[model samples]
Target: MSARLRPTSLPWSVYEHLAMVVGLVSLAVICLAWLPLALALRPVLRGDIGQRLGRLAIMRGFQLYLQVLRGLCACRFDIEAIDALRDQGPMVIAANHPSLLDAVLITSRLPNAVCVMKAEVMENPLFGAGARMAGYVRNDPPLHMVLECRSALRHGAQVLIFPESTRTPGYPANPVNPLSRTAAIIAARAGVPVQTLIVEFSSPYLGKGWPLHRAPRLPLHCRVRLGRRFDPPRDPRAFTTELEAHLRAELAGPKTS
Candidate 1:
């Protein structure tokens, strides 16, 4: 898949909204079905087994979602280094946020991943119940979020954090937002390396305000690549600067075949 990472109007735009509605309804049903099970099974799937099961459910759901998007929406994916995550450890998997799907893609691949999600999402009807029960971290009160993530990492679990803290403004050389340094702080204090993961989509189907009805390129595609794993620098400010530069380079690099 050729990498353009920009938006373009296409014929498929016509079906985009319909597909989205169908997908959303299906997802609601799926989540509704599992949320209760997650609540009820909390006692039985206790300890490591419960954690594993929850993550597995998420992964399988994403797998199915990807299939649906591919088949119904004609979107394609070019993902690399997914298998590399399996061998990685209790490390901070930092990423450049592009779209909401970014987290799903990574968390799906890293079955043991502990994601740090926004407080609103933690209370959302579609995701809240399941996520809370599944043991993901809530991004609130910076200290609690940091401690939770750090503990998860120290316990030999992979933690995914969008260092940008929110979706990007959506363009190359875009101004990096002044955001929370929670991710950087967590990695530094925990003595874990920050693995920078770069995600570039062929179509910016969902930008800041772009609706699900917006039609992007046919067979929307994306490229997921792994960048360097950096040992936490002593200075958090310097680390954030370097991380931004590194992510910019990764996002601006030549497209892969």
Candidate 2:
């Protein structure tokens, strides 16, 4: 029989701490460096040009951050599966959010993908400027969020959303949170397929309620695998049920390295 997977250990060695610092500083540098450019171009480059530039910048920045992690932080990521969706045309890219890095992992691969971010994060100075310029949808005032998602889909951009709406609660015990119907509703209204992606982490380092100041185990491993894609739903409520069940099943099945 296969052995049950255990949580990764948190080590507070000097190497581990230094790795964490490197990861955090590299990310901050990348985001801050792009902030000025993003802010400056926000008004001048409106519409598709702005979106393309913003999303591309975010993607490349994230890619560079991941490279830093891999090089100096002993992090391993298997996220190539996401690249397949880059040219899949307009679609709702739904995923099970396990950690804070889920969006960064997926978006780093798809330059044309726009995220569905929290209303507050969409206003934060650190990330808001670039996100706004990327034409990312803000998850507030439900009606407006759906309308914006549909518009982005119509523009042939993949809409990246976490159906759980936030990081999954109760980690190992609850593989996923009950999915919000937003993803289903968006896909239904946009007439786009819901492409599911399953994100797994070696440990719950940056999961819900995890502290930013806390250091994690070295050699953190993260993997993203493509999941089932459901056709545009005629009944969003039913689709949410099915999507939630499917995600739970996939996450519960097995652990892969």
User: For residues 197-251, could you state the per-residue lDDT of candidate 1 as single tens digits?
Assistant: 8887765557555676664555567667788889975788888888888877766
Q: Can you give the TM-score per candidate against the true fold?
A: 0.88, 0.94
Tens digit per residue, CA lDDT, model 2, 1-257: 11332233233366677887888888889989999999899999999999999999999999999999998887899999998988789999999988899999999999999899999999988998899999998999999999999999999899999999889876756789998899999999999999999998877878998888877776688999999999999999999999999999999976534
Pairs that collide, model 1: 74-219
lDDT assessment of candidate 2 = 0.89
Off by over 4 Å in 1: 1-11, 172-179, 254-257
Alpha-carbon shift of residue 127 in model 2 (angstroms): 0.3
**Model 2 stretches with alpha carbons more than 4 Å out:** 1-12
lDDT of 2 at 100: 90
